[model samples]
Target: MQGAQRNSLRLLQWMMAASLALPIALFVFTSTISYTSTKDIADREIERTLDVAHEHALKVFETIDRSLAELNEVVRGLPDEIIRSREPALHRRLKRLTDALPQLKSAWIFDANGKSLVNSLASPPQDLSFADRDYFYAHVDQNIGTFVGAALTPRPPYQGARFFGMSRRRETDDGSFIGVIQASVLPEYFESFYARIGSDPGSFFAMGRTDGVVLTHFPRLDRDFRLDPTGPVGQQIAAHPEHGLITIAWPSDGIERRVGYRRVAEYPIYVSAGLETSAIRARWLATMGQHLVFGIPATALLFLLLALAFRRTQHLHAEATARREAEEALKHSQRLEALGQLTGGVAHDFNNLLTVIRASVDLLNRPQLSEERRQRYINAIADAVARAAKLTSQLLAFARRQTLKPEVFDVGERMQSLHDMLATLLGPAIEIGIRLPAQPCLVKADAGQFETALINMATNARDAMQGKGRITFAVQAAATIPDTLVHVSGSHDLAGGDGLVSVAVSDTGIGIPAARLGRIFEPFFTTKQVGQGTGLGLSQVFGFARQSGGEVTVESEVGQGSTFSLYLPRVPTDLLPQRQAPNTAPAVAGSGMSVLLVEDNIELANFAADGLTELGYSITLVDNATDALAELTMDAERFDVVFSDVVMPGMTGLDLAQAIRDRGIRVPIVLTTGYSQALSQDGAAGFDLVQKPYSIEELSRVLHRAARLRPVRDGAAE
Candidate 1:
């Protein structure tokens, strides 16, 4: 059962871990795939935007080149002097061309001496020197097909705005350069077109010369800017001169971007469009945030449910364990109850038979029967009765119904006496060792039962050793009983004080197996083979310890040995009673005294009445307490003492005694029983109690003592 519960808990823990980990793993995986796909989409969009910008740049430059071609054709065969003479007509034609195209700022023709002979800005061209201009110098050497220059502010009329020029070199039939025809293109033309095309935030658009000169940019630069010759975009363009895409930081502001570039066809220029890398990241983050908004709660709820299930399983496991323990306790209680009933009944019946035999034996022990054979028969019968009494005592002890006479005694002194007795009983092959405390260890328990328990433990140990090992008895002051034993005993209420005295019996024997340790205290449970053991030794010890308000603990290892320790509630040394030496004098006979004898069994009643008659007691026999009560009520002064058996049919001896006291009867009552539950629970109840199967001599002394305890009556006054 415990194994299954643990497995269930382990499975839940694994599921909890998986529930959280799998979702996060999937979310991260899906987010990664989405990011890559989104970036690919962004790259394609950049390429498309760059394609539109590239087309625009190509058309504008081609138009500017065509105007230059037309201007060159007008002066194809004209001499330098004729071109100067036809300047007014050429200026009118250039003005018409500039008006037709919104992208073109103006058109110009430069003479070989670097004089601007014709211009579109003014009817008579300004005195701008073509000798210092880049276009004029380039045409002087060789005819480079359509040369696109760096952005610059044009002279006068086109000033305050930046422009780049497209120029063509004019040559004679000999292919020698003579002059230049140039057209100025406005940077605002591409910037306005880029705005119209509609780009995202943080997007860039630019056109630049292949020589790394930036011509025009949307969201224009504060000052003229150029791409570095050795930078990322510059290297990208050099590697793929026609068209390609690259992600790089803009040299102007260091903002990372995904850029697409294309080289305009047959022109020394490139166009690019880009969107910032931060914008792509923003798109990805927004998508992932949406996933988290839904995913996090689902994971949390799964964890919460798993946590609840784990707690619920633990609760159920606890309840199951509690229920199992309860059932076990109930079964044990029932077993003890049944044993008590059986033992009490058997002991009660057996004691009556022993009483009859004892009475017969006492009759034979008279001095007149001086024959050796008759004396031997009486001695043998007496021995048998004593042995039978011991047997019944063991049964009553195991049933936990034995009468206990508790007295505060020193444990160390008691063990010292047992050390010698056990040594002889266990034989020469066994050794007995004794360990005593320096100070007296005092306990309140039945001294006879205590010795019996120790003897039982020692005998078991002797058998375990096969009568060939060492047995040790020790006494000590303990703070409390061991927690393990406390739980095993389940007698927490017995451990009352901080002071506990431990009397431990240890043996170096073969030891008990672990599998059998827990059942060793159960009645009829023994490791010995049949007929060799009664199996009630340890159970008797267990019941005796519990009935004495203490607990017994056993510790054993298979090959090492076993220790049986009794933990009894300690008493103060001051509570110990003064020891009295045993009196060796013969039993005193009774004078003519009256005894009201209450017995349910007629044979046993006759036997007791005859025995007491021989002891010089005047007996009034009654079979039940009711008859005795009626006799006492009729003549309260007849008997001096009531010697009633404790167990009878209608009313018990204890109840009769109470009735006598309640009726104000002045007689002393003496109760006797073999085994009575009432006697066990309520004790002697201020009445003197003698166990059954008593010797006639002992019965004489008890009747005499009870008669002595009676109150003297004022018969003269009555």
Candidate 2:
């Protein structure tokens, strides 16, 4: 009987080993197969992603082409004489064309002579004399009905920005070649399209021209990665343009990822999609785990029954662990992706507000102003200008555009300066209250930006209450977010040990609706009526807080008004000196300097010339830079100053200045334009700039300043 028991035990051991070995081998084999399958699935998904990107890109291109075609058709219908002679009618048509297509940065028609007849933008070049331009020679043929030009940096009349061009030939009724109607699409429009491509956090999409010039990339990678296409991954893509997938170690994240790519058949563009290998592995593991979850118990039961026949529990545990890890990774990727989108939207809107404010302030410094009214105007202008500057600093902070400029300052004192202004801004209906710490609570921040952000928030609160509710500006230091925030009532939590400084603005107005509350910080998305708001207020607050290594939170109910809290990182530091106010405007007395004023706007030009003449300066007016240059060449020292519109026909103001300088004509040049920022970053160096919509006194002041600063030789000649 003992020998029988021993034999049975040996048999059981053998059965268990056999069952375990077979299933263990099978699990390994199955997991390997699953990994392979997941890789294949990922490749297919990436291919689909590329196809969608291409389709969307083509749609964008087609829409632009259609708009260009319609514009060309309109120009083609007009009589040759009307098209050539009627500048007003042509301007109206061009304006309509551009207004209908905001994505088009600028549109213009070049006559057979290469002269720009009409332009959507201010002051286009008048002469087609420059033979080097693509449109100049291309339009001379007039046989090309429609053609997409190479990616080229646009010149004046086309906004002098980087743009992709679409051009079509315009002809007379007799089929005679007339000119070319060209449209330059802005880069922002393309960037917007790229933004929509890859929604997944682990996924990145890039589109590059056949020449390997990257047109756009989603979730913009580092600039170095964008610039050097000759890197390992770029080399791989260059070697294989057809549909393919390859595993590569991504330098940015230090992770191995599978990149899939496809080149559009007829277009010189390639679309590439990148997916993290770990993500794919995780997905496969989760799927395999789900199967193992159901298969495990059944397999165990089978082992129990088979143990009489075989015996073992194998395979399940290892598979389950891998699957769980994969599921966790996917969840993490999704969370990060959602967060990125939220931050990106906030940044984009904040930038737009900065753009508007910067442009608006630059327009305020025009030369013409009477001494009597200058101080009052200058004071009001300075207030507006300061607000604009603060807006940009906040954006830079939010975008992490610059290093933090932290300083210790009393929030109470800062709020005091703006108390009266806020009251006036909110109007008589809204009651304002300020709550401050008894002892000055020192906090760190770029003082100017911090103050601006506070003012912006208070202004928004007042607006929300519709000028009828009570608004409170409160500040304190806290170790923790107070639970009883509602009843805090101007309390300060001192000795909280270096915590954040909390600035809260609360209003007793109608609360934000739940749906729109999430998007209040998006640029150009205002709840206010058109023209009343640019929809950047909350966005600035949000960006400023984040940029300062701080956070902003909002809470609101349907009926109760909303409260916005900004928690700025605090530190002990000395406060910076306050900004001193500039004195009232200097006297505007024009020196009897002869000025050559070149402008294309006939009425505006005449008005400006009249205004300048009234200011005691002799003015020589020309419709375009060509005639101005002609008159200047006729007499080098003919004028003390050359004032030209930056955007004009034949030669742009910048080009005209260059030409004059080339001839060693050092007449002090002043370039003026409504769209000054779009011209050039440095502007016309060595020359002064005066933005448009200038009053007579402002013009005289510019002339006076220019005359005063003239070179010794030029001043002696004048």
Candidate 3:
């Protein structure tokens, strides 16, 4: 049955994949064909456009040819004397022809001796000699068909208009040359005509004679336009002769163009038109786009539908099983990896702290140590021990199984105490704000976790803003449960109240993006650059909140900044067991005072007791708090001070102190621990507290201050 089900799931997946992919594949294949067809159509259209323009260009040549042919007819019929008479009717007819063809600048009749006959002008300005002109000189044996001169600017009739002069030799009936009839064609006429036709900006239309002598062109109206017959485009035209289409890099702009050239059989002129390749490609893409616009989305929707169906039917079961296996493997691996890194980071910091302690302790052993130097070393040791204790405190705060000690305390007062430390932590660039409640807003949470979370948030805010921004720590109590928190949780340990305490850390800094907000609390996931972060800070905060039966939520907008709010259950301050004020009295002499020391580590107990004994105190060492309690119970007045480690297998030092006080004993109990959430509270604060790995001097001072001095062990007290 399982095998059949798995086969069905596999078939469903395959069917879904085929559902989306088959059509897309078909579209791709058909689209390729469609695109190719469109491109071909574009090429043909481009060719047709070039051909039409080329035909238009050739028509201009035909007009000039007809005009020349009419002039030939006049020369063949009219006698030299009649034409030379410069008859008004004949001159008007010549001017009418010139006016009809805008390309023709003028038509003139010049005798073989270069004397003007009928120059087509209503009035002659000056006598222009054309005896030196190429057309007049080309008359060889009276057999020259038609002569086209190079570009020239003639006087009067032609004015300053540049054109190629077309001339035909005039002869008498005996086949003797008589005069020359010439017409001027200004290229500007072609330039103006081609401008109205739709073509690419860089495209050109040209009319030239068979001998590679260009007569006129659309562009470069200021000069002659010609093409070399041996060039690629010219060769293509020459090879085809009647009409030719070839793509080539046009010489004028060096852009590839599809050139269409047609040779005019009636007029010894070839008309060539050029269209840029870029214009053709643009047309092709536009055509291809029309087909793809609808096809792509249809494919995507099919894909989405198939994915949803697969996820609903078969993927959920497989995924859940695979996810469980992967999560288990990944969790075990990540725990080991993160633990290793945490251990290394902790050890490195501890090494520095340990070095200070070691150096101070080694120096204190010097026989010739100065009193001032000795004091400095002792101070150094104490400072190192305090720093090391805080480091461990951070570690314990993040420990997975460490039971949180939830207590009710004023949130504002707690934050106010950390203000200076936070300021130093964030640096001078960041401003700190404390928006505390007017009245005490007591919340049930591990105070140490609260402090860590606050510090972590401030640090993150500082980093987000690159150390320059405002961070506000605010606390408030609510009268009702937040509507946003929809579910009532079973682990909700907030002091049974109408609402929870909201402790917020807001910063005017760079905010988190919505997509990354959810994963920010995941361990070993950080946006910070390598070597800049351990990635456990936010995870620790998250763990603290959940473990304490509270919840942390954040609100942020990019550029506007971010706010992290921790909601803890509120409790009445009056309900908390009141603690005595901390003892701040100065240290007294420990000389000859009897001290009972309880430490689980036998070596540590021996060392500490020996130092206390050497300091002129009677020392009684015990391995556990139970033993010390029994000893104290037996003879409570014998010892002046009870110094014990806060952590043990059973009956912690704090428990012993509570037990001692509960039993009506008045022994000044001094406890030593690296870090204990229990000892970090209001009740424990009244007892003299000292961090472990302390030098003899620190130990002496705390014990002296904590001592409820009885008669000296030597029995010499006044």
Give the number of the best model, judged by lDDT: 1
- Candidates in order, TM-scores: namely 0.52, 0.34, 0.44
Q: Which 10-residue window in model 1 sums to the lowest lDDT?
A: 483-492
Number of clashing pairs per prediction, in order: 2, 19, 0
lDDT against true structure, model 1: 0.82
Reference-based lDDT, residue 13, model 3: 84
* lDDT tens digits by residue: candidate 1, 1-718: 7799889989998888999989989998999998998799888888888888888888887878777888888889788878778888988899999999999888888766766778888867776675666656766777678888778776654465777778888778998776788888889988999988746876788888888888888768878888887888878887888988888888877788888888899898888898889998888888899999999999999999999998898899899889989998998897897577456645655676577677767768667775875767677677768767776777778777977777888899988877678888889999888899999988887888888888899999999999898988888998877766523344557754648898888999987777777678866666788558767778788888888778888888888998889888888778777879975555556567878888888998899888878767788888988889899889878788888899888788899999999999888888888999987777898888888878677777777777887778757363
Candidate 3: segments with Cα more than 4 A from true spot: 1-322, 355-380, 400-408, 413-425, 444-452, 479-498, 513-549, 557-560, 573-582, 590-594, 614-616, 624-718
Best by TM-score: 1
CA RMSD of each candidate after superposition:
17.2, 49.0, 27.3
Query: By TM-score, how accurate is candidate 1?
Result: 0.52
Report the C-alpha displacement of residue 80, candidate 3, in angstroms.
99
Instruction: Rank by lDDT, highest first.
Output: 1, 3, 2
Point out the worst 10-residue segment of candidate 3 by lDDT. Answer: 485-494
- The pairs that clash in candidate 1 are 114-130, 114-131
Between candidates 1 and 2, the TM-score winner? 1
